[model samples]
Structure formats: C-alpha cells, structure tokens
Target: MIVMNDSQYHQLVDDAFERIEQTMDSDDFDIECDINGGVLTLEFENRSKMVINKQEPLHQLWLATKFGGYHFEWHEAEQQWICNRSGNEFWSLLVESITKQSGEELSF
Candidate 1:
C-alpha cells in the first residue's frame, strides 16, 4: 500500500475528477467532490442520485447508487483502483475521465 499524506490524497481525488469530466461529452454534466468527514463524496449534476463515497481506512471504499454497490481496493504499487468484487471497469472510467479532463497523461 502506498501511503500518502492528506495533500496527496486530495490531489489524487482532484486528478480523478478532472479525468471524469474530460471523458464526458455532455456539456450539462458536472461533478463535485468533497473530502471531509473521513470520506470523499462524488456528486453529479446530471444524475443527482449518482453519488460515490470513498471513506478512510482507505483500503475499504464503498460505492453505491441505483445500479449497485461496489467495494474497491486501492493498489498503491500500481496506483490503480481495483474492483474485482464489482465492476472493474469503473477504475478505467475514472482514469480516463481524469486524463481527458486534464488533457494530459498520468504517469501512475
């Protein structure tokens, strides 16, 4: 597990959101994330009901919505998100989203 300070965690979250926005073609969509209360909340404008939270103890993060629930694992060595217990594709989407938004490639 790669241990990061609070600042690094915040940066990762910001980078992830940037990627998500870039991947979306719709102009009416917006995502807001908050990292407080030992959790990270991702809120979407178009789909208000679609919200995701990443809680502390960081290894065990839970994602929930109308679709289903996902339990994620963070691979620090790979700097990737893993969801073998659910849809693994989400990690890619997030990465793509950040990349698209930043218009830059991520080394991790």
Candidate 2:
C-alpha cells in the first residue's frame, strides 16, 4: 500500500474525475461531476448519485453508491487505486457503479 499524502491524493482523484468527465460527456445527457472540497459527486439523470471522497486520516479513497460503500487505497506497485477489501481497481468500480446506476457503460 502507498499511503498518499493529502496533496497527492487530491491530485490523483482530481485528475481521475477530469478524465472520466471528458470521456463520458455525451449529447444525450451529461453526467454531472462536481468536486467540493475533497468530495466528488457524480449525478446521473435518474437523480441517483455516486460519491467519492478522500479519507485523509486513513489515506484512503471512499466511495458510496446505492448498493454499498467501498474504500480504496493507493497501490504504488500497480500504479492504481485498489479497494482495501476487494482489491478492485478504482476506475473499474466507478465504471461498474455508473453502469449499474445509469444503465450506461462508461470507460475511464
């Protein structure tokens, strides 16, 4: 595990969402991606949401969906953020979450 400092964690997440936004932006409807402080909120057309935020004290990223909550930590060797419990990569989880909530496939 790579324990990321607040600055590094923020930059990582900030860049991730920016890429996701660019890739997912479509003419049909926009997936609203907003960042306030350390929390990133993605809103689907159905008014459902997926929330992602940094846990500074734990050096982890936390995600909340309608189905469940998941926590991820930085993996330096893999150059990815992996779930603390499941080891699922952060981008995969986010894509799955969006697909489940919105019935659309997103790649990031």
Candidate 3:
C-alpha cells in the first residue's frame, strides 16, 4: 500500500472536483472524502446519485465523477482505469494512496 499524507489525499479529492467543474455545464457539485473510511460522497445539484464501489482491487480505490451519471473503476494489473458500467476503457479522477494516516495527519 502506498501511504500518503492527508494533504496529498485532499489534493486528489480537490482535483476531482476541479475536473467536474471544467467538464460539466450544470450546477456545481460537492465531494466529501474521508480517507480513513475509504469513502467519497458526491452531492449533485439536481439530486442525482452516483456511488463508486472501490471494494475490489484491495490495494487501492479510484473513482472519477463525470457527466451523465457514469462511474469508472481502476484496473490495477493494466495500470489503467475502466468504465465497466459503460463498457469502456477510461481515466479515473480518484487518487487513492494507503488508507493509513500519519501521526500528524490525523485530526481527532
């Protein structure tokens, strides 16, 4: 597992949001990522729901938010991400490192 600092994880999440802002023409969306729990919650303007399943490929989890409510998964062996839900090979905006937080990175 690749352990990452909190700042790095937050940077990844922020980047995902930036991608959405650039690609979508609709209202802005918000993403709340909790690295310790390995979960990302995306709230859309029109109340659309998109859940990313990152359970498999144990070492890491990658999720990318896009237009038209599509989801993608990361292929570790291929070193690439795929949109299994849409049957296409694509990119992932999710930047996942190791789940553990360093002593200073964790805020109680």
Best TM-score among the predictions, by candidate number: 2
Provide the lowest-lDDT 10-residue window in model 3.
97-106
Clashing residue pairs found in predicted model 2: none
Ranking by TM-score: 2, 1, 3
TM-score of each: 0.49, 0.86, 0.33
User: How close to the true structure is residue 99 of candidate 3, measured as C-alpha lDDT?
Assistant: 14
Off by over 4 Å in 3: 1-36, 57-78, 84-87, 90-108
Ranking by lDDT: 2, 1, 3
Residue-level lDDT of model 3, residues 26-99, one tens digit each, is 42324232323445444343344333434433323345344333444445466444555655543322222111
Winner by lDDT: 2
* Candidate with better lDDT, 1 vs 2: 2
Looking at model 2, report the run of 10 residues with the lowest lDDT sum.
21-30
Model 2 CA deviation exceeding 4 Å by range: 26-29
lDDT of 2: 0.81
How high is the lDDT of residue 86 in model 1? 49
Tens-digit lDDT track for model 2 on 1-108?
876678887787777767766775653445787778878788888899989887878878899999999998888899888998888999899889889988877576
lDDT of each: 0.53, 0.81, 0.38
